[model samples]
Target: MTLQQRQLAADTPTRFARALAVTISLGCAALASMLLAEAAARDGFSGWDGIRAVLVFVTTAWLAWGASLALIGLFGGRTTALRPDLHAPQPRTVIAVPICNEDPLTTFARIAAIDRSVARADVTADFVVLSDTRDDGLAGKEQFAFARLLRETDGAGRIFYRRRRDNSGRKAGNIEEFIRTSGGAYELAVILDADSLMEGDTVRAMIARMQSDPQLGLLQTLPKIIGARSFFGRALQFASWFHGPIFTRGLARMQGPTGPFWGHNAIIRVQAFAESCALPELSGPPPLGGHILSHDYVEAALLARAGWKVEVDETLGGSFEEGPENVLSFARRERRWCQGNLQHSRLIFAPGLAGWSRFVFLQNVTAYVVSLLWAAFLVTSAISTLYAPPPEYFPGPYQLFPVFPDTSTREITLLALGVLGLLVVPKMLILLHAILLDRARDFGRSLRMALSVLTEIILTTLLAPLMLLYHSRAVVQVLSGQDGGWPANQRNEGQLSLCDGWAAGYWIVLVGAAIIAAVQWLAPDLTIWLLPVAVPMLFAPFLIAWTSLPLNRVLFAVPEDAAPLDVVTEYDSICDVWRLTWNDEHLMPKATSPDLTHATA
Candidate 1:
């Protein structure tokens, strides 16, 4: 480490800033809870009203805490001053891409693109393709694709591929195995998902950051979503390109010295990770107990516990990852994440964890837990309206004319508006910032940006209930000891048929119908208020199917859709070549590498 880097690592975030983040986050949540309690009491109090008020407090507090982060991100200081100089010496780094049953052609093509990018920058980095594919046929295909990658990029020595027979610990195990065998050769490792693509300069910049902060264990980059074609994917792309920066910046500020590792598309110090991140399995069986499924968070916590800084650099760009193209695909991914996050419940109180690390576990826990809470709130509100007695305005010995009850509709409306503001103002602030900074052009300019935001809001709102149900189910299943086993990501897969979409979402739609019917039969007056939540449930299937289709992608077009990235364009061509030409008998040249000749032999 350089003298300057060592000096800077000595100065972490001040206690005052950490306290401020906690104060603002909790303080806002507390104030929002107080307001919700007051609003609930505006109508004469009841036990049911009290329950509603409590749920309101918990849910709104969660929202407020998020808002606080974004606000801090907007107004907080940055680490730009601590950034490493570009002309400084570089370190030896290994870029690791973990792949399972993925499309070998597309995955290796992406690696080729990344390898070329790194080669162009003249950086001393090796790329490794670690495969955990259990299927022999798919593994063979991956080997052939790796050979193609080697031939095409002329990366025989610099790029390597290895597949494991037993997919024991999944991606985490794959990485750990690499670290044990080959990690000694490099100072740092840039971990990437199969779909990850980092520009050569971004890779160099991240390495520089690591070199500048010797105590920095991991530096996560905010990767913009690329190559999205469906409406769902495009919306995500636009959000990531535009609003994602603000969110990540806020998270970075609040995280200070202890940020997060999102498993891939980030750089990590080899020595620190190897020493601190050897994950331990919790004793027991499936879902709730076993090997740590979400190993990234635990690894970060371990690093912080060992007094290493894990920070995220949101200002750095040119890193990219693909998103699921449709809602069902997204739900499938979320199902796995849901189990992983829920699994952290057991580790929340693990010994010697930093306070912030523990809080992060809670944050992951809340991400899915809030959906259940929201669902419960809806159910309780329905029950309260149906079975609970009418408001007792004359509870006391009031002598005068019996007081009349009022729902305080105006106050309720304003409260709803306040809650909406908390939920959306951060996004508005992001939009305003982009416009003011002239960054709106990156999202297709102000007019289209506004339209895209509007479309995203509508689509997300319609899809929220479905997600809530999906998440709620996943959590319940996990809690009931059902494990969501490792599933390969179906990147950019075809759309589900209407029947398939319906099959995936029938339970959700049925529950929505049941809730609406129950509400209408018990309390007709409350049905209107319930429509916002209930209507989405009924239309869940249609929403999933519609968003899954390639149609309407142009309607909410993203900047990438309008003008594609070079890597994305190249990847498409490579996919066509592999798909159409792989089966041709003589595609492989006569005198290939010995390893390739032997593997195919």
Candidate 2:
């Protein structure tokens, strides 16, 4: 074998060894946490309930997630059996790309690209640029301009545009209107996010799968991040590309026909959606009422509740979307998600919900609760530093009597390890999958990839305390009836700001600093336990911004196939052409109708 091949082989084992070492360490920590909980229980520690609850939640999540993987391995291995072949002669389908207040030109370009891509595969699908932009002046003009441009482009014949005069449920309303007015003509409807793209083959596969499985109401693909242009964005893209498949596979295994709908990059059986997926107006006040902020989960639940299947096809590759560009954008997106998940608490307790629906709701609630717990754990650690009892400098009479009190430091350390294991093991497992499946090539050299993973973990470890802080704060804000207004995120490429950092990252830093000071003053010998929390806190702002950078651009560079736009130049050219053609044979002047003459007479 050549030296390069030999070096590659040698490198593989080293990488695998590192992965194995981390995996073993995490597993040992998980086990130790369980044993500590059991020991604490036997000792009748009054505060063990909280520790036990955390351990139980952690262990249950781990096991439940594992069981999900096993189920997918057993049942989902044959998932292709469930998908239909769209290559056969099939009825015409309509692909709807929904847009609200967005960059209309970008939105139209994406729709055009998707249309062209699908057409290249010889897939005859109608394209609908569904706009829910209200009849407000600016948005209305943009929509009209978009419609005119689309008609002048290749989409003139096959593409259609519809703008709602009254925007009701936003996206859900927009989709419902299309169904009510024009859905009857299509066999299926594939929904695409304004920023999403699907390769022609993947789209064909989805349609084929739907055709084969008449029982399948929705087939959603895992979307890869493709256009991130910052450090954080690159990390997110790498992490998503590496870890997303495992979680998705696990989720799909457990979900069956009750999987989630992320509101985009999925195909739906039109009749089934119309019949079963109508979203109800959520009751109560702001944040939880009027319209569902998270209509996707609820819609999926409603579909499953109505006996229609909703499944995620993790194998459907080449589907892509953009991630939030920075920390502020991430928080804005997460805040809305938090409110939506919290609102699920009501539905969780509501009677008559299916078992899987309840499970789905519980999953969403647990996500928010877990964020709060991480924050709580940080607080508890800090308090323990300040309030915990010192070691016995002298042996007590009880020592002579043969009974010994347990060490609080050991217990706290074990608890900390347990939390770390829960967070880190999943990533290690994903990395293992990457190596074993020969997918590490996409991440650069094995050494660099390993370094990247280590860097990501270290960076993420530091940011965890901060994320907990922001998410907990957001959760509290929502619960207290505060509104997180809809603001367009800052997409400018830039460094972290002190104000933005404090808004999203202050909690971890403050908490970590407090812990360190308390440890120095109260428990000098136990300061070692603060390392995990301290590193992240010290570099909270940089780490927060760096990890949240638009990473997609680095991982998946823009393809040569992408279309570029010069907005000002294009508009001028379009205006000149329209003016010259105003009196042409195929054109009719505005306000020159028979009704005008009748009114004048």
Candidate 3:
């Protein structure tokens, strides 16, 4: 370890914090495994039961690790601040917004709003639209929009737009190209997605932090979901508003120097990034080979390897991004992410990566793998029951697999309940913590926040099976060598008709029906027990359509709306005026974003 990292490690509580989190996770996993193994060993402990026990450990460990992070944040108290929250930005910072097959009007208006924000703050920052758009028709629209945007924002030299005809490397490549060509002019770069938005103050804050610490290579801010209108969208917004911070805080405490970079809504030292974050194509073919899929995580690891501090600051607000308004869009994005993460398996042994960075890759892979493991466990459970032998009432002392004297039903019920508790308890605690700390009033008082939490929990619970199926499919596709290519995200009007939902989810329905039919004939007794898992799948199409519909803001009114950020309000006003103009000219479709409409109202 370098002297700087050693000092930071010694000064910070990252070691103790990580150790505690892991110990808690492992302890819970081991206990749950023993209980599950005892419960499954009812008729006879077969090789299948042993295999299940191992799977249970891995799956439970993943769940418990997540819960532990939140628990740590709840009790861990005050995380250390590495930067002094500097306010003055010394040199010009380029705001690089990477785009590919996106809405030009909505995209350019954002640039206008952000330009106004920086101009208002009197901070020296430039906006660069690094376009990787492929469609010729859309490329022309981008030109028109860029011209109009320049006129609207009076951005002659301050704002720039460029589209690459040869879009080879995608988003990462887009950013890298800019750095290679125009990066020398700027000292700092604030990278953002096409949908990402940030307040002038927040940009100043991140720049100040970077300026304050020369060793800081990258600074990531927690980008909250904004402008979500649909039911699924609002639920996500609430979860991010209510639950995201706690988890983010926990992660922030542990990620001392080698913290994460989530691609966008972050600031990076141009020199450091240019020198350290260049990625090489991995040897071999597609899926697990070729170009790195999730380049942000790899870049963070590389920066750390180069002896630069990479940190995430969740406390900084005014950073925001739009999300897919429906489950289909969300799943499509998740599928791409799954492939990206699984592709990292090849880099686990890549030399010079920090231990945590290596573990981060494993964590990503296991996240999807746990769903598969759960699927495997269920299948194994059914087989073990089918081939049951006479119960071993008299087992040897100090047996490797315990044979319980009591009814296995009770043990199994307890184990199941424990797993559910692990999934739920942390969220309930976060809500309680919010109330106790007087933070719940921000979301229209404790009562409404309570309702939001309950409603979100119930909704997420119903949707869990569908999401599990989606993730399982993603893992299978990646493993079977199917590349989930860069799919364009659906950012606006996320509603899905029943037909559309059905078209997307018919296979899920079929899979659910198949499981139920298989179990009804083979294991008649367990048929009722499996309804919770199967019923959701059967109704997934309807659920998807339902959740995609818009919801009243009364229920999920965000704290951000309570006191609007400068950038958010600016963007909304610009959107309202632009929509008015577009609708008048009959050149664009109407229906301004709900978040924008609500804020403007």
Candidate 4:
């Protein structure tokens, strides 16, 4: 029942709506660029002014685009629901959990929970643990964990484990290997990462949707963050729970059939994926050349190219994931993604790609490229200021008076407000939307939700400079041909100490101090303007460590915190009981690492 291309037209927005969104974004960008150019040209137009104008145009467009999406979600409302055939006999399905150097205990527990969850929903599905773990010691522990998991779930035959000798292709390659060998056994595969967990009913619901829509090749669920204990982590959870859906709803609306694939927490038609997504290695060396690091987005584009509907349903709930506990972990994850995205520059012109696919790649690249432009703008400004000509009093014929240049202070203020508005107005509007619709109840009622939003806004504002520095560095590293090898994610990277934060962030501190000193000495007028960004960097280690420290968990509370989902509660209980079992049997001693199940649980 492959859906025809014409059938998708009914679901897409009118050309007018899409056109209007682009119009709004570009218009905002244009005006902001104009304001910047005027301010820069007050003394005299220079190359630095031109560069600054272009940078502002690109970055403001992105910011405005983001604000536009939120507005679209707020106004356009939720997507029209596609009815599913829910009570029908479930299809042959396999929940594939991918792991690489992840904790065997916590990782396996998530699988066991998912296995038991599906069973409880009266849905029959096999669970597979695809391990690309490289450490021999970790591999030995994984086998023990698998045995324990099988025993606990009584999934001796239902659950399976396979470790690859050489994980050459990374995650995409790992999955490709699985499909190459065992994909034909199942019609649908629920792909999951080591940190991913979903409610039984959510999984069942997705399958139903796939069953109902023969044209649908993949369905992505909005996975919420859970199990956060640190301040930074909880803020991420709250924002995802609150702001993420509205933005995602807008994304889904705009995407129609050409949606996104975030690699995991998605269900795909195995046959469609196999036939369409045989990714080719680009013509080059490492970084830009080797196997594609970010394969999910490409897979979605491929599926769309093959006439399959790729969609994201933001309304569907119960999908879950974890976030980095601190800035360091986040930076590490972001660096790899940076490389993955910049690699897309090569594929932007690849043959047979859809127009939207190319645009999406452009957006991805622009997101990081904007950071470089910004850094360049600042450098150019510094250089220009250092060698600026002194104010001159010119006589038309023989006048003895010096004329001072207008600072265009008002223009500068207006431009700052416009840029600030793009960032703040969306969050404020979303807050108002929450109040109007009484959606705050979902985030622990109005007062706490409002407080959470306030804290998140402030915290994120403080972290902006840090992120800017990291993004710029990552882009530079990729350009320099540095390879950020495939490193396994440390899902439980716990509290970072001051020393640890300092170790990772000292360079930033130095940079910050240097910027402030140079600005104060060379450009006294700009010293006040740079304080907000410089202050945070000067205290980067403190900010990072403090955010990572264990918090009360009462303020930045999400829906999951207030009322744990059935699957989450069950997962915790199972882990507790299993840890006790391991301790009693002395399988993993308590004297080992702090994160070892036997020691912590």
Candidate 5:
């Protein structure tokens, strides 16, 4: 009695509710954009002022739109629960764990934990370690780790491993090869990243949803960050735990059946994926052309085009993934994603795509393109100040002497408040919602959660200028025909040396210094406004190094960090055993050292 054999009613959000949510979202964006344009044109509009105003309005409105959705979700009640037939036997699902040159020991331990979890729930599934490693040394290490994981779990036939010879299209190609070669044996394919870990119940629930809704081509789970070490990673973890749910719920409601696939922690109907998702090489060279770097979004669009429902179920919990420990690693990952997103401009008008799908593509591209707009705004502002003609109030035919340009401080202040409200109000709403729902305990209680949110706001505010510069440079490089080749993710990229940090962020510091000098020399009034962004750019290296350390964990301890999940605890215990098993002294041991196991326990 596989899950496909079960028949259950699928309940979706009412079309009116979905439409109203979108209307609120777009309405907020339109209001903010108008306010921003008025603010930009306050000091008498000029030719260059038009561009700055348009850019500010678009970027501000875009952000406000997201914040509006989150605010709406906070008041929209708990997520809609979709009942599934859990009593039916689980279907034959393949757990595809894709990897490259990641830490094999950690990867294998995560796999073992997931395997044990599914077995505990008595789900019928198989685990596959699909490696796209081009390096022979890393490939050997992966195999050794995989063998140890198999032995420890007593998994011989249930788990398998395969490394590709020519890592042609990277992860997308790897999965495609598997789908063509081995995906036929299973009805559902649960795609996972090297760092993904899902609880047995989470996996079963996702499968049941797909089975209940035969029209569902893909089901995505919201993966929370777990097992963070550094202050940066922990802060990100806390923020995601606290605020991610509200935004995700809003997004889910808006998406309806046409949702996003984040490349992992998602299950796809094998037959549908094979039929709709054979990505063709874009007709050009590299960077903005060539093979698609970001394939997940395109796949979702194709599936929707082929009449399959792709949804994100934010209500489902226990799906987890690890995040980068420092800013440098995060920037590196963002660079690749930035290039992939820009490539979508060519496919935006692909034939037969849904309107929402096209909007999604536009949104994805804007995620990175906004950086360029910010940089342009800053440059044009400075130029406008440096080369401005003195305000001449007396007209040619007027008899009066010189009259000063009138400044509307109250109107400007009101516009500033509007922007600030859009930025900060949603977080406050989410906080109130959490308190009302008695869910503050999950984030270290009300007081601690409030403190954490404040800290996150401060840290992100300080880091925004540094990120702006980094993203702007990435966009420029990609536009100039540069391809950021697929690089393996380093799971435990620990620290940022001062030199490395300076090398990565020196340009931002220089630009910040130059801007401060220009503003103070030409436009003294704007110097106060520039300090917030400039100071952070000047100290980016120190901030990066400081946040990469494990210091101040007690100050910002999230609920998960304060006390980890049971599966995390079990994974840690398993990792300790494997660590000793890989040690030279215990090289020949068939079983893990008793003392080591007892020590972890």
Candidate 6:
């Protein structure tokens, strides 16, 4: 055999072995946990309460999550297969792109591209550039530039720009202003973030769904990450593109009419949103205070409460958005999301919400809490090793009390295996589905890509604990009244510095290093167990930044053949026509209609 072919053949078994090892480990851990629980029950150890609680929580959560997915699959299967016939009529729709202190040139270029693309598809979509910048100095220039650019380019009559004199509730406030002023004229509104892009078909599909089901208030599409120039950005894009669909599909199926609203790249029935979805001020501190940071979840809940459906159509393709390419930028984005999700805790138990709405709210809450719990589990496991005796059970005799015998090392090893399996096996299931179901082709060559999948999974497993640590700390800080102010994202692509990494992950590094050093000094034999935790902790920052780099992008490439372009085309054409019409009417007065001659002169 050729050397390259031999190498490829050799690597296959190694990858399979690694995957098997993870599966075996997780199975052992689960068995150990079960045995430990039974032993604790027989021995009457009071400390088992916490262990029992954890087991119950994990088991129940898994079942509930599974049931939700099954329900969604049943319902989703009933809907007619999505096709061109599903496209909604060309309604007068307002496309609102909200911006705040973003690069004007980039924003304008994207809007112009979208305008051109939508126009080509013959879509009648209006453009609204809603600015929420409070910096008075920059606002005037932005407004003037926006107006002139629209006139000079293809944005004249069809595209409009508005600046909130007082940026009150931020993004939510910006949208409210538009609805109050001119929302009545449009049947539907498509909200897009500055970095968001969609194909013409996706938008049309969304409109079609809304038209078909008047009860549907919002239709959110799964957005694929794109335009990632940096290494970090590319890695994030790859992971997001590769893993997002299954999870989204699972989530949507589970959520039904109570799915999440991610703020952008979704269509909303204007009347439903206007009548039921209003952002309310939280009468408290920084994270949960005056302005709502994360309005998407709350809006979705409100829509559900008001008897309107909020659905996430994973089957609807062609939506895309850019992710933060730098560590600092990624953190900044996370901070805002953390605060928003945290704030939802206040409304979760509010009396008026529907059961489905409550379920959705609880799901958002769980997303954050699960991170903190995983971090706690790691820390507590280490501490338990130091303070507690190994597990033991004893039978009663003619004595006052009986002590349990210590658990075998075999049992401990099995328990560890089970825990690892829980972490990695589900992903393998997803990969298997992709390969067998023909979905793997989107990633790359089915055979070669299988290896990439294994590699990505290993890297991700090593990195998961570190992310849990970062997000857990963020959640704690926000809950404790820490103010993570609105920080601008680092849009530039550059090499990450040691200081930048440290700044982002100092807590993780310090804790991990200290634990490793202590274990090495006091109990060198335990290094094997500590390696799993210590390695990830010590290199938390670098690992995070590296994984997000462009090198990882290749693994995430959605075989160019499967790329979603219908939505992209629609978005582009809509923006294009708006710009063209605006430019012709406002800039080139010599080509104006005869009726407008007096006004032009």
Task: Name the candidate, 3 or 5, with the larger lDDT value.
Answer: 3
In the order shown, what is each candidate's alpha-carbon RMSD? Answer: 5.2, 11.4, 4.6, 3.0, 5.5, 12.2
What's the residue-level lDDT of 177 in candidate 2? 87
Cα lDDT for residue 552, candidate 3: 87
Where is model 1 poorest over a 10-residue stretch in terms of lDDT? 592-601
Q: How displaced is residue 215 in candidate 2, in Å?
A: 1.0
The C-alpha local distance difference test score for the whole of candidate 3 amounts to 0.82
| Per-residue lDDT of candidate 2, residues 1-601 (tens digit) | 4332232121333234324433544565466556556544443534534554464455445433443353343334333534455656776788898776554444555665566567667788888877665435436555555665576565666788777878787778889989999989988988887677777777888888888877778888998775566666666666666667766775665565577898889999898899877777878786766677677888787766666778888888768776765666676778878887888887886554456678678777777766666556445544443443444545665455444556555665665666566566666666665677766666664565666677677766666666766788888998899877444343333456666666666666776687788777775755776666676776676666655544433333222113322322233354456556544323321333221110000
Model 3 TM-score on a 0 to 1 scale: 0.93
Output the better candidate (1/3) by lDDT. 3
lDDT of each: 0.77, 0.64, 0.82, 0.82, 0.77, 0.65
Per-residue lDDT tens digits for candidate 1, residues 46-159, read 687778777877787788777777776777747463556655457889999988767666678888878777877677788999988776766877788888889988888889
Residue 146, model 6: lDDT of 78
lDDT for each residue of candidate 5 in 16-85, tens digit (9 for 90 to 100): 4456655765666566556545654556667776666676666666677677568656765345589596
Candidate 4 lDDT, tens digit per residue, 169-207? 788888889999999999899999888889888898899
Off-target runs (Cα >4 Å) in candidate 5 are 1-43, 87-89, 386-389, 393-402, 584-601
Q: Which candidate is the best by TM-score?
A: 4
Which residue ranges in model 3 land beyond 4 Å of their true spot? 1-12, 77-89, 390-406, 582-601
lDDT of 6 at 50: 51
Deviation (Å) of 90 in candidate 3: 1.4
Clash count per candidate: 0, 16, 0, 1, 0, 54
lDDT of 3 by residue, 201-253 (tens): 78888888888888889999989999899998998998888888888888877
Candidate 3 local Cα displacement, residue 527, angstroms? 2.4
- What's the ranking of the predictions by TM-score, best on top? 4, 3, 5, 1, 6, 2
